[model samples]
Target: MTYFNDFDINENIKKAIKEMGFEEPSPIQEKAIPEILSGRDLIGQAQTGTGKTAAFGIPLINQITTAPHVQTIILTPTRELAIQVSGELQKLSKYMKIRTLPIYGGQSIGHQIRALKQGVQIVIGTPGRIQDHLRRKTLRLDKVRAVVLDEADEMLDMGFIDDIENILKQVNTDRKTLLFSATMPPAIRKLSRRYMNSPVTVSINKSEVTAPSIDQVYFKVLERNKQESLCRILDSKDPELGIIFCRTKKGVAELTEALQARGYLADGLHGDLTQSQRDAVMKKFRDSSIEFLVATDVAARGIDVNDVSHVINYDIPQDPESYVHRIGRTGRAGKSGEALTLVTPREMKHLRSIEAEIKMAIPSHAVPSIEEVVEKQQQSWKNLITDQLNDDEDLSLFNALTEELLEQYEAKDIVRSLMKLNFSSAIGESDDGYNFGETGGAKGMIRFFINVGRNVNMSPKVLIEEISNAVGIPGKAVGRIDIFENFTFVEVPEDVAPFVYEALRYSRINGARVNLEPAKPRPKRENRPRPARPSR
Candidate 1:
C-alpha cells in the first residue's frame, strides 16, 4: 500500500500520477521502481496489467535530462505495445519536456525519420522498426543511458532475439538495462545473461494464474460448429457485457457479422479500423449500446471498460502469455468474471499449454442444448413481460379486448397463443431451427458497403439516423453496422435494400462524396488483388 509520495518521485510526475488516478503503486511498480532508480539493472517478472509500464517509466523519466540525443530506447513486440508504452511515458514526462516518440510499422517511415531527426529524447519502437532505423543510419544510440525490453519474452517468441541482441550491442555497454517479461523462459534467461549486467530480479504476487478471480471453462466441438456453439453459450449465459476474442482481423470481422445475423447486438474491432471507428465502438460498448464486442488480441488491448462480465475466446491463443492476457480482461478489481474458450479436438494440445502455464486445469463445459436455450429464452421473455407490466403504461385500451377474448375462449388457450407468438418473434425462429445452425435475422437482409465511415465521423447511431431519414425506414430496422477506415457496411431488409441503395446513391458525409454498392465478399489473402491507392 505504498503511495507515490512514499518515494522521492518528482513533483510533476506525482501530479501526473495523481491525475491518472493511481492511488498506490502496484507490487511490480513498488519493487522495481526503487531498484531502477538506484541505477541498478533489473529483471522484472510480472504479467500484463501489473503497472509495469510506470515501474520503468517513472525512473526513466526522472533520470533523463532534456538532452537532444536519444537517452532511452524501449523495444516492444507489437506496434500496439509500442504506442501504449510511448503514451504512458509521454504522460509521465508531460511536465518535464522530455520528447517521446513511438516508431512502428503501418505508419509513414518518412514521418518517423523526420521525428528522429528532430532529436526525440525517448523512442519506443518495435524491434523491427528500431532495427530498420539503425540500418538506415537515421537513429544513433551513442548517448543512450537506459534501455528497456518490455515484454521481452514476447519479442523472443516473435523471433526478435537477434534484433534485440544487435540493438543491445549498439548501446553503450555501461547503460542500465531493464527487462520486464511475464515469464523467464530459458531463451529469456539466456538473453539476460548475455546482455544485462548483474541484474536484481523482482517477482510480483507469485500466483500462477494472472486472473485468479475468473472462472475458466472450455467447450469441445467441431471447428465448423464454433459459431453455433457460441450462440448457445451466449443464450445460456446472457452476460450483461462481454468480449469475444478472435485470432485475426478477418476472423473478428466474420464472427461479428455472423453474430449480428443471429440477432445478437455485437460489433468487431481490429487494426483495419480508423481511430475514430475504434473510439466509437468502445464508446458504444461502455454505454451498453452494444452488448458484445468481438476483437482480435491486438485490438482488444486498449479496452479498459470495468464491467466486462465475460471473455469468450473464439480462437485459442497460440501461446500461454496471450491466453493470460485475453482472460485477464475480465475478473478485474477483484470482481468475479467468467472466461470461456471454444476448443476443437485438434487444439487440445494448445489448451494444455495454456493450462500448464497457469498451473491449473480448465474444466470441460458441455455445449448448451436446444432445450436449455429455449428455457433460457422463455425465462427472459417472462422477465420482459413482468418488467413491462410493472411499467407505468396505461393498459385500459387492452383491458376491453382481453375481457372480450376471455368471455369466448378458455384463459389457458388465450395465454398459450400469446406466449407462442411472443416466443416466435423474440427468438426469430424455432429452437429446432437454431439448434440445427440455421442463421436467423430478417431472413432477407442484404449487406451493402457504403464509402463513408468513422473517418467522416460516422457512427452506428448517426448512420442509422441518416439512413432512416433519407430512405424513410425506421432506424430500429437498420441492421448491424461495421465501419472501417474509409467505408462502411450495413445490413437492411433485402426487399428495401434496393430502395435504400438508390436513395443513398448521391449521399454525402462530412462534405465528402459518397458511393453505395453491394458489398463484395472480402477476398481471402491468396485471392485478393492489390488495392489501388486512394484518390487525393
Candidate 2:
C-alpha cells in the first residue's frame, strides 16, 4: 500500500499524481518506482494493465528536468501504444514544465521533427519511427538519462528489435535502461543481457491475477437488493471516480438510470451505444464531469482512466479474468483503490470459482447501514474543513469567532453543532432508515415455515425432493431444512424463496396439505399439538 506521497519525489510530480487521482502505487509501481528512482537499470515483467506505464513513467518524470532537451525515449510496438504512452506521460508531467511527443508512422514525420526540434523532454514512439528520426539525424540521445523498452516483447514480435538495438546502441553508456515485457522470450532476454547493466528484475506475474493495492470485498445480496446496495456503498465510500461493471447492456442501462435518479453523475456504456455516444461518455468520465460510469465488459475494453477510485461489480464477473480486469481499472497510478462485488446466493458458488481462479479469498461484508453512511459523510466534511484550514494559513480571521464559541460552549458540543449545521441532511437522517427487515435467514438465504413435517413422514430428503420438484430446481438448491412434528423450517436461496413459497403453499406434501410462508425468527418454544404421523 505504498502511496505516491511515500515516494522521495518532488512536489511537481506529487501534484501531478494527485491531479491524476492516484492514491496508492500499484504492485509494479511500488516495486519498480523505487528501483527506477534509485538510478538502477531495471527489468519489469508485467502485463499491459498492471500499471507498468506509471511504474516506469513516474520515475522518469521525477528524474528528468526542464533543461529543454530530451531526457528519455520509450519505444513501443504500435502507433496506438506509442500515443497511449505519450498521453499518460503528459498527465503525469502536468505540473512540471515537461514536454512529451508521440512520434509514429501514421503521423506526419515533418510534424514530429518540428516538435522534436522545439526541445521535447521525453519522446515515445515506435522503434521504426525512432529509427527514421535517427537516420534523418533529427533525434539526439547524447543527453538521454534513460531508455525504456516498453512492451519489449511486442516490439520484437512486430520486427522492431533490429531498430530497437540500433537506437539503444547510441545511448549505451551513462544512462538507465528499463525493459518491461509481458514475457521474457529468449530474444528479448538476449537484448537485455547485451544492453542493460546488471538490471534488478521486478516481476508482477504476467497474468496480473491480483491488484494488490485494491481492497477487494463482496456483499452477499439478493438480485432485487443490488441497486440499493450499490447506492449505499457509493454514499459510504464517496469515491472520486467509480466504474460499476454490469454483465449486460440492459444491466448497464438500468444501473445507470438508478444512479442518475439518485442524483449521481452517471452514464452508461454498452454495445448498444454508438461510437460517438460512448466517446462522449468516456470524455465526461475522464474530465471528471461524470463521477461514475456504468458499463458492460465489452464496452469497457479500451478504458484506461487512471483516477478511478472505485470499481464496483454490480454483478459478479463471469470469470476470474474478467474480475481481475474489472478491479485493475482502479488502484492505478500509485493510488489505493476499492473493488466491491454483489453476489446473489445462487452466484456464491460462481464467485467461489472466480476466487479459486485468482488464488485469493474475497472477504464478505455486511451492507453499510445508513448510520455508517452518515458517519462517512461527516468524516468527509471533517476532512474538507481540515484541508481548508490547513491551506488557509491565515485562520486568524476565524480565531475570534472560534474563541467566543469555545467560551460559550464545550469544544465537543461546539464542533458537533457546527457539523450538524454544515451537514444537515446527514445529521438529521434517521438511524432506522433502510431497514430491509430480518433478512429471513443468513446472508443469501430466506427461511420458510412449512406446516407439514415429521408428522407426514417428512425428512430433509423428502422435503428437498418435493421442493425441488415443485419449484423446478435442483435438490441441492435448498439450504438447511429443520423438521418439527407439525411444521418445518426450510432455507432456500433468496431470489428463489418467492417461487418456493408459491409452489408449496396449500399444496400436498407427503399426502398432507401444507401451508408455507417466509418464517420469522424461529419460535423459542412451540406449545401446539403434534399431528398424526402419516406415511408419504
Candidate 3:
C-alpha cells in the first residue's frame, strides 16, 4: 500500500491517520494491514522502529466499531510496551469511540479493577500481569475476538512463554492471532504452529533489519576511561538528540549524572523509578527538553521517538538481537542516524559476536584526542555562526555598533573576540581538574562503609565484583578494599562515589544484609610513586 488512503478503511480511520500525520504506510504495515483487515491470521517479522505498532493498531482499531467490550487482547513482553501500544491504539481510535485499558505491574490493581468494571474494548498488558488478573477472576477473555503477541521472541527470552500459552488457552480458539517478532526463532515458530491457524507470514527484507542510513561504529577504550571517552565523543559529534544505553539501572543514573555535571542536558530512565517518574522522563525526552536519555534495555521498550540523531552504547548489550533494538531507536522513518558503541579491550570478543549476529562488520575507531575535539568544536561554532547569519532577521540596530567596533579595532581581531566570548559558554574547561585515584590503592578515593565484613569471609576481589555488577562500573575503577570485624570499607574514585553509594544502599554483599554509608576521612598512607589522576 503506497498510502493509507489506498486501503479500504472507513472515514473514521482515515481521519485518525490524517490527524496523526501518517502519509504513506511502512512496508510491514502496507502488507500486514490488508491481510489483517481481511480476517486472516497474520505474522509480521520486523524491527522495533518500523511502525509496527501502527501497522497492527490501525487495523485492530478499525475492526472495533461496536460498543465497549472485551474483544481484543495485545500481549507485550514488558509493562512499558503495554502502555505504549495502548496509547497508540487510543490515538488511532480517536475519531471512533474506542476504549482501551493497559494492565501491567507497578500500577495499582484496584484502579485497574475499577476500569475493568466500567468497561474496556481492548486490553493491552504483559503476560504475567494479565495472568494475575485472570486468576483473580477480575479479567475475562471468553469474548475476545482477536489476540496479538508483540515481540514474541523477547517474551520468550524473559521466560513469559508459559504464561503466554496459558493466556492464549483462555481466549476463543477461532479468534484471530497476530504475532510479531524481529526474528523467527524456533521457539516463535513452534508457538505459531501451536496457536495460529495457517497465519500469513509478512517479513520485511533481511537487509532492512537495521537502517542503512545509520553510521554504526565502535570506539575501543580502556575500562576505566569509558566515562571520559563518552564525553569526548559527545563533544565531537554534538548530536541534537541522543540516547545512551546502559546495561544496569545504576549505570543509567550514574551516567546521566556524569553528563549533567559536564553541562549536558541529560536524564535517566530505569525499572527502579515509579511509573509516573518514567512517564515524566519520557515526556521530557519527547519534547526535546532533555538532549540525552540514558536507559536500560527493558525500560526503553516500546519507546518510539523521531528526531533522535544518535544512539550511544555506553555498555555492550548481552546479544546481537538487543543491539538491533538499541540502534533501531534512531534512523527511524527515512531520516539518517549515527550509533556509537564504547568497548573495552576485554570486550572485543563480545563485539565480534554482535557483528556475527548482525551479519555485518562494525568497524572500530580510535577515541578522539583533545586536539581533534577542539577542531570539531571550532567547526561547530562556525556552522552555528553561518546558520545565524542565514536566518532572516532585522540587523539594522547592530550596524552602528559594528561600524564603531571596526573603527576601534581590526575587523579580524573584533571577530575573534566575539567568537571567543560566544564559544566559551558552549565548551567548558578541559578535564584536568578531576582525580580518578589509583586502581588498586586508596590515593584519591572515597571510602564507603558497608555492614557485611570479615565475619562473612568477604574478600577484596568479591567486594569489587559485587560493587561493579550492582553499579555497572568497571572493576578497574574500584580502589582499595578494607574489611573489619562486622563492617567493610571500600574506596572508589571520587566521581563514582555517589553512584556506588546509591546502588549499594539497596544491594547486599555475599547474601548478607547490608547498610552502606559514607565513611569518615582517614589519614593518608605512604605508598610508592604512581601516576597522577586525571582532572575533571
Best by TM-score: 3
Give the candidate number with the greatest lDDT: 3
Model 3 C-alpha RMSD to native: 12.0
Q: Model 3, range 1-536, lDDT digits (tens) per residue?
A: 39999988878989988898889998889989999999999999988888899988888888875666788999998877887788888888888877899999888999999999888999999998899999999999988999999999889878999999999999987799999998788999999999999999998863475758788999866565578778888888889999899999999989998888777899999989887899899899999999999999878877778799999999998888788888988998678999999876446667878888777888767677776777888876788899989989988989999999989999899988898677653444455222424333366677777877777778888888876754456998898776776777788877556556655665667788788877755536745324234469
**So what's the TM-score on candidate 3?**
0.67
Q: Estimate each model's TM-score.
A: 0.62, 0.49, 0.67
Evaluated at residue 260, the lDDT of candidate 3 is 81
RMSD of each: 19.5, 12.7, 12.0
Mind giving the per-residue lDDT tens digits that candidate 1 earns over 268-344? 99989986788788889989999999998777753556689899998998788788777777876457789999876
Which residues of candidate 3, in runs, are more than 4 Å off? 274-277, 345-366, 378-536
Order of models, best lDDT first: 3, 1, 2
Location of the lowest summed lDDT over 10 successive residues in candidate 2: 427-436
The 10-residue segment with the lowest total lDDT in model 3: 432-441
